[model samples]
Target: MRKLGTVLAALLVIMTAGWAGNAEAAKGIVIDGSTTVGPIAKSFAAYFMKKYKVPVTVSESGSGNGAKSLINGSCDIADMSRSMKPQEIAAAKARRINPVANVVALDCLAMIVHPSNPVRALTEAQIGDIFSGRINNWRQVGGPNFPIVVIQRESNSGTQETFKELVMKGRAVVSGAETQASNGAVKNRVSQTRGAIGFVGLGYLDASVKKIAVNGVIPSAATVKNKTYRLSRDLYMYTNGKPAGVVGTFIDLPKTPDGRRIIQELGFVPKY
Candidate 1:
């Protein structure tokens, strides 16, 4: 009886090991980077997990960090609000990671201020001056007589890079400007601070704050798609190579009807 029991115990152990190995083989994909893309990524992750029974993890550590993760092979997908720069591409090449961009949606970088602000619109030059610290007072731009508070995204943010390129026009943002890490943080700071001015993706806009038109063009889905909004940019998902398997399906989500609905529901311009 002892010999029979020992053999049965060994067989059970082998069967359990096989099950464990199968479970390990079912590991899920990981996505990280860009708080601006966090909402969309999370929504897609949730839907994919439910529909496919495949686990997916998403994180928002800003765009620069996302690129770093992809180059380092730590993430399966890197969501970026702005395109990768030349230096970034070079770095990836050195690491043997071929970063392929998958354009997912369109985003308009909306300039936001407290609701009480009366300024209707600002020219590109005026917007540039305000961020660069040249126009330090709200009264300088025909608003109330108060000092302007500039809120900017942190240095590692993709939104900050885009804002500097498009709105600053090669000018530097003021050193004294307040830097927030995420779009939600910037929106909250501007909504609560009457004299504050900040920029966020169009999807982040809400009733808590008011958006200002740039060069007479208000940021909307139509304006962004038409390229009439100066602050518009394409959102991207970067894979190490041409995406395959689960990664390919996730990146291709925006082209489907359900994915298009998800993009539009989140206030972004859907491609399909």
Candidate 2:
């Protein structure tokens, strides 16, 4: 009888330890960086935490900050708008942090103008001129009589980098341009202010503002998937060293149908 009691107590101890281990494994996931990728990351974090019953937190400072946080071991995942730079990758390697990038979504830089503006499309060169302040009047682009109000993302913005690389080619965005923090902010300002032009992610588009076609090319999923959307870029989640635990599970999310649905419905293309 004493022997049986000992065995039962040992079993109870093992069971309690197992449960504790499982609880720790499902604790939480931390994500940070990239305002351009913020909406998508938030969406994924919400869905993932609810589905897996694991807590998750996400923050957006910028892609550079995200990469830095990942290298510093402060975040489980880092959201990014562009691929890692060579120097960033080298830095990560020095810290023994291998950043495995999982492409989660695609976004088109939706160049927006106030609804009152008649300019429905812009050539790439015309856009360059407008943002550079070389063309300040709407009439320069065969539009209204008002002068154009150029809006831009802050310099630290990942979207800004992508825009510069893909469109501006390192030429400075106009000196007096208004700089906003997030895509939503840019959309709101352009929506309410006539003659204002700004760029935002396609997910933020609405009838309140008009999205201009760049070089006669419309921003759409089909165009982006086919590599025709000139201002499109891939959204990424960077995990340190191929990931583990909740981070690893979340990284594999795009492989599921529900994940893909969320990606497309958010106005971004899914990584195939």
- lDDT, each prediction: 0.92, 0.87
| Candidate 2 TM-score over all chains jointly | 0.88
**Poorest 10 consecutive residues by lDDT, candidate 2:** 21-30
| Candidate 1 wrong stretches, greater than 4 Å | 1-26
Tens-digit per-residue lDDT, 62-118, candidate 2 = 998999999998888899988898999999999999999888888879899998788
lDDT of 1 by residue, 1-272 (tens): 99999999999999999989667644777899999988999999998889877788898999999999999998999999989989999999999999999998999899999999999798889989999999999999999999999999999899999999888878889998999989999999999999999999989989999999999999899999999998899899999999999888889999999999999999999966
RMSD of each: 5.1, 7.9
List, in order, the clash count of every candidate structure. 1, 1
* Predicted candidate 1, C-alpha RMSD: 5.1
Consecutive 10-residue window with the lowest summed lDDT within model 1: 21-30
Please report the candidate that would top lDDT against the real structure.
Answer: 1
